[model samples]
Target: MEELTAKKDFTDIYTQESPYEYLKETRRLQYRIPDSTKPLYLSLAEQLYNKLHKPVNVLDLGSSYGINSALMKYNLTMSQLDDFFLKEKELTKEQARQFFQKK
Candidate 1:
């Protein structure tokens, strides 16, 4: 536990004003986004919905920038997200909002 707690602090990276930087840093380190587990999550959500006969809500802990939520809700892959961020790196706030509205 001590060794775990002693790992290099990444608060600065996690607290960035833009998620672009965080994604870039993680991509640089070749960190996998666990997007492959989307099918499992979807399956579980479907089961819950069927059992409850209603829409189910999810709580994604530590959901920095809501990558998981975006992936699940928008049916997006990590590669697509990376490409989108790279291509739209210079988008203004309103432009970004419009983009999502179209999605």
Candidate 2:
């Protein structure tokens, strides 16, 4: 069997001053695990909601920029998030607030 090894230590990336910059670097590196797993997380949340018959609180460990919370709460796909962050890169605080308020 072929062995897999990590090529880089991403500890430095985690220490970026801006979360957006970290996300941009991760995106550039094609780190799309969260995007791929979003469906599974959403399904699990749905199952929990169905079983509990109430709001389900999710704790996202190592949440970083709260991507999981934003994805679930806004019902957004990773592509949408990428577009928002990458394309609309200069949004002011109020604009971002209003944008998410619409979501």
lDDT of 2 by residue, 1-103 (tens): 2333856465776785435566676667777778778889989999999999998899988866777888888988666777776665565767667767999
lDDT of each: 0.71, 0.74
Collision count for each candidate, in order: 0, 0
Q: Per-candidate TM vs. native?
A: 0.78, 0.74
Q: Against the true structure, whose TM-score is highest?
A: 1
Q: What is the C-alpha local distance difference test score of candidate 1? A: 0.71
Window of ten residues with lowest summed lDDT in model 1: 1-10
- Model 1, residue 62: distance off in Å is 0.9
Model 1 pairs in collision: none
The per-residue C-alpha lDDT of model 2 at residue 88 equals 54
lDDT score, candidate 1, position 36: 72
